[model samples]
Target: MIDFRYFLVSIAAIFLALAVGVALGAGPLKGELDQQLRGTISAVSKEKDGLRKQIADLQEGDKYRDSFAADIAPDLVKGRLNGQKVVVVALPDADNGVVKGVEQSLTSAGATVTGTVSMTDKWSDPSQRQFLEELATRLVTGDVRMPDNGSAYDRAGVVLARALVTRDAAAAGRKDSATPTIMGAFGEGDLVNSDSDLPQADLAVVVAPPVQAKAKPTPDSDANQAWVSLARSLDSASRGAVVVGDPSAAGDGGVLASLRADKQARGAVSSVDVADLASGQVATVWALAEQATGGVGQYGAVGTTDGALPKRPTAGS
Candidate 1:
């Protein structure tokens, strides 16, 4: 309804307002805007530098802690195991350094290191579960009772535990069933090999690494249950069992992570969650010593550990 002239006038007014705003920004606000930008850049730089320094400081502290733990570890673990015999079992992805450290810690504590057992990654694979079940069924003897747990891994674990460990003192004298035939079968399958004389060790230290997170958890995601079953079976079979692991193993998918969480197993075996550290290694030694006396506790930096170490083993225990 308006004339064309009125439309043009409105457009002109809009342009005029824009021009004034530009002029004011360039003429008056330019210095303030530049100063604000400079201040923001400086503040960002300071924050970045502070973060870098903090990271460096944390790294330094870690080095100091490791050194301190190493220095005192030998003294702390000395004579703790006196005359005990121990077998070392390395699970898949286990740290070689931690395994060596565990042996050192145990040896320092006066325990005999019979040898080491290295388990293949395939040992934990769900695909091979049927094979393990078949093997377990074949190996299970008249005296050995298969566990009622539905998991094939659990069934195998119990069968293997019965074959490997001398649970009964009276059975220790037997000639045929006393020796573990499962070791020979394991060697045949190439699932595990050990230097341990098929060792009838009085104590077992099952070493497992941290459980890494790669995908969203599904039913297949939690292989740590296998470890839990094995540790429980091992604990029942041996005089004592101490399942030691890295922090990750105590994390989301961890096996020993639930050692404290599972009320049924908590009182029967010992566990240490920080096996990578000297403090953790020392704790493991004390845990083994503690277990020898029929007492059990969890110790570590992660899930379910009571403290950094278990109560000191009593004299002559």
Candidate 2:
């Protein structure tokens, strides 16, 4: 007789066949799956196209803004700094294009560009701190003293600042003149180079850009602090001083960011953080003019800027 197990096996095989058929129907055999996938892809493509168009519109708007600013810049800066003498100091990482743009604006504003000084990376290198201290003593030949008690970089900054800056050119006289000594010393040591003939200047403007530190540094040990000290000292020594950088300087760990955070330095010197373009460079010159008149302000698109530029002087107000 046929075993009962044979019947059980036959029943199990029938159930398995039915399960497979249902699973296949739910999967690749499903009629609507392909159409659903196509619909999803089409929706995504439409979204991407819309986003592209939006980006293009924004870029075109930016181009128009830049063009408009360039056209109006000259009229805004006419005779702003007439008969003033100015000097440019470019930090190691400062943008050459921006620096040149700034020079052009100063010229357009009727300010004499005395010269430009290009600083080397060694100016702020921690590894050369001791050497900088010795060089600082050698470079500064005048009566100017460092009140910070010789933190190498700080002292060096004070020396350099006093050399490049001065309160009154005529009253102070030759005894106060440190430019020749400083230039000779720096030239001999290769700390700085005059991009052209150096002349006496009544005001100073420093061109710096946002820069990353080489490595992890203690709170006050970073190279950026050197710039802060230099800006402060230069402001004190000169009739006016202003620092010009880009919008990037508003970011974390930027030189302008640090300078703005310092309460003492903030008011001592003026700043314009968007000096990359013609309009911004005009703002930079105007800020310098304001500073020379014993005023301080911040002007930039971002960071600690007080406004786009100082308010236009009213009719003899």
Candidate 3:
């Protein structure tokens, strides 16, 4: 609808404006613009260097703390769990190093670690539900009673707990007569792996897997809930039980996180979310001792309403 001349004039005006802007950038405004750009770059460089130094200092501080905790760990946990028999239960994907560290810590606390029971991936596999339920039903003996109504894992927890742990101090460190048969069934079924000579323990420590950054399972997912059920059942069946994991395991979708979010589970079992560290290892010992004395707490770097560690017991307590 516009005239041809007007269109041409508008185009020419635009080009002229661009030319003027280019001239100013190349000539009159060039020095000021370059100075401002250099100033911005210099400020950014300074900030980056400052941030790097701060991060380095923080890292060094963390290293020092970890070293100190490791050095003092033995004395901190010494005799805390004396005369207690503890079992280490390694969940699927559990870190071997963490499990070993936990066992060593328990030993340092004067507790005898009966053995380690490592759960297979099939322990929580959906397809194994029927097998687990049937096995648990078959394993229920006069000494071990299955819940009237519960998930397959929940019932399996009862059977497993009865085989591995006992609340009676008189029976501690001695295997039940049916332990061999029960554990053999689970082993043959690919539900768990354990030493052949495992004795019944008075307390239990469940080592969970570290958190995954991607594709993390939901807190209420069946697998996680099944694990929670097992842990709670262990606590109910044993003298005491504590679940330990790395700090990342306290994050969303992590087993420790999921357990903490569960009201009933958190109320029954203790947990430590920094089991990968020396401090958390000491905390695990303290938590177990606390459990022996009828106390329950959640400890470590996250959701620790009970504080970083349980109260240290008095000498000879």
Candidate 4:
């Protein structure tokens, strides 16, 4: 009769506390408790890492913050469009930055420039490959003239392409036999399109490799069929020149030799290896299908070098 209800309540609370204590200490809940602790530790570790990064960033200074447009504006005013346009196209990422750099530099140099800012990533598109291929093809062919672009960068490409074409053309003309026809594969799978605005020349300058072996390999049967088809089509059109750019993967092995042999009766085959090489002799072996007609061209050695192209300056320039 000494307040039984109060004593009962005290007992229930004590039992609940004991149950919790057992769960935490060598009980079923021990694993769950450890997992919670580990999670907390991991969260703290990540926070520490984030803080370290912030400190590093502060130490590095704010060099990434700079104007791109201010740099080109001055050149634009001085009629130095070539260098400016080249710079702009190469650093298309810095569209606004370039515009800003140009504006500032031009204004300081007593010139006014105006243009809409376009900051888009154009290279991400796959069509760029085709565009570049087409441009390269045109450059290799002396017959086609590059269109004149008002922009400086476009003009640069045209100039460079024309120069290469002249050099390559002279080389092709001097070694005159019947002009060899070249067929290249630009598409994927079996649906390769042999018919395009490809050049028809005696020397098919395949722009697939940067540096190839002096000894050209033979083409396969399937490749041979495609080459035959291309040759016949060219023959019917009365085109004297046959040139190939960016050869298909199948244009290897005996197939090339067969093409050469077939042409030997009428003319000679002149091939250029476009495979990029690193640290090896650029060797190309030419083999004729019937008569082991073969020749080789060795190129200088190359290496795995980075920074093949120029880079944009940071905030400090």
Candidate 5:
């Protein structure tokens, strides 16, 4: 009996030793396993971001230039606006006939031309011309392939939508819909206020340079900070449309930043490079903008909702 008891104690000791060995082996392996899991999660996150960007581009079909473009589509396609002022911007001698032609078509449809301002520098300024050339290159190589000669259509669609919304609102009785007219400046420093009472505007058009087409379109750190400051000074919901002839022109970076930052501001936005944009493309952009605001003509629901402009301003003040 004594011998059996001693043998049983020995067996229990051996089992305890084996248990300790198993725990020691598992500790290092557990850490390695945890590290592997973290790596996998990081990789998956990056892949998801890439996929989402691709999906967004596909969904937008060249309209992803900004967010407001997405919000104001309905009114542009319906031709809900006419008789409102549309502002256009570019160099004085840009030969941007496409931009003017599209605007005219909208006016013919019923929009009022409020103002047109051109930059003094057309081709003589090296910095400005460089900007245009670069912008043209980007248009050709970037996702927004400027239709060799049909760019006016795109320009027309975007502008037309904003005009329609502005005019429709003014006609509907939004007393605040009107704004003081202003021209695009190299750095206009917050030109218009969304809340100001003014000359009874049906719409506001801001013609300017494209600020995001440079080999390094982004401005330096100091410029970037100043641009943000300028954006904060403006009304949060300024409704307007943009027509860009060159993306690399001076002061364009600041403009793009401010407009993009004020994402929810009540407005429509579009751009065209007169130097590179084909006639049809510009027309299409303006037409789309007009249709979103319910201006004159109709565009198929490529980017609009319910095919209706923003509720026309309350009927008659």
Candidate 6:
């Protein structure tokens, strides 16, 4: 609305300022600005390189530790569980490598692995609760007493535990007439899978799924609690039972984490939360041996009030 000359002058002034800035950048300030930018890039690159080296060092350290643990694992657990019959139960998504490592560790400790029982996803599906309840009721033998009050999974746990473990040494490693029937029923129901007949064991190792980075941490979800109920039932029915999982399994929503949070279950069940590592496998075997003697502890890198490993029992005592 004002004079056209004033608007033109204002535009010219802005352009002049920009021209001056460009000249400075290309001339007097050019070297300084370039030097500053180069310095910044160099500093950032150095930091990145430093971080990479640190990560490499950590990885190498871990590799060395795992190697050392594997070498000494046999001696560490030698005769610890001599003559004990142990069973491995793999929860859904359980790491096969870890399960195999645990089996080797148990063998090194002189415990006979009866068989590996793999739980299907149906075990944790809420929709299958009614079916599981019916199955448990139908398959429960007279000798196996059902819990008066608990979830359907609890009843199923009792039935499954009765078939897989026993406190009596004579009964262990010996399948009774009902053993195959019970296992077969669960297998047919698509709740459990086993490669061969699973003899009753003196102790049990329940392998939980490894830590899932993307999974929402639902520590108290019905599915997770179902597993907890099952584990508790197994512990009650067996000589002792230990739940093993990877380190993150002790984080939020992990089955091992849920077990640790439960006051009653934690009191009865021993947990090892680093089963993915050789050291953790060794700890798992030791935890089972501890269980054989009425000891309960949570051992691992995370969520563990107990020490890294149970106290190694002295000879014959």
Q: Which ranges of candidate 1 are over 4 A from the true structure?
A: 1-27, 148-150, 167-180, 216-222, 314-316
lDDT of each: 0.77, 0.76, 0.89, 0.30, 0.38, 0.89
Estimate, for each residue in 1-317, the C-alpha lDDT of model 6 and write its tens digit.
Answer: 79999999999999999999999999999999999999999999999999999999999998999899889888888888888999999999899998999999998888899999999999889998899999999998999889888889899999999889998977888986777888989999999998536788989999998767877558898878988998899899888999999987888888999999999999999999988988898889888988989999999999556988899854221
Q: Candidate 3, TM-score vs. the true structure?
A: 0.93
Judge candidate 3 against the unseen true structure and give its global Cα lDDT, from 0 to 1.
Answer: 0.89
lDDT of 5: 0.38
Give candidate 2 misplaced runs (Cα > 4 Å): 1-30, 148-150, 169-177, 195-197, 212-221, 314-317
lDDT of 1: 0.77
Best-to-worst order by lDDT is: 3, 6, 1, 2, 5, 4
Q: Write the per-residue lDDT of candidate 2 for residues 7-102, one digit (tens) a residue.
A: 999999999999998887799777677688889999999999999999999999989988998898877777787767777899887889889988
Candidate 6: which pairs clash? none
Backbone Cα, N, C clashes tallied per candidate = 1, 0, 0, 51, 70, 0
User: In model 2, what is the error at residue 293, expressed in angstroms?
Assistant: 1.1
Residue 51, model 1: Cα distance from true site in angstroms: 3.1
Compared with the true structure, the alpha-carbon lDDT of candidate 6 equals 0.89
Q: Is candidate 1 or candidate 3 better by lDDT?
A: 3
Backbone clash tally for model 6?
A: 0
lDDT of 4 by residue, 248-280 (tens): 221444222334445441243322221221101
1 or 5, greater by TM-score: 1
TM-score for all models, in order of appearance: 0.83, 0.83, 0.93, 0.22, 0.32, 0.93
User: lDDT by residue for model 5 over 196-223, one digit each (tens)?
Assistant: 2222334333333344443334443333
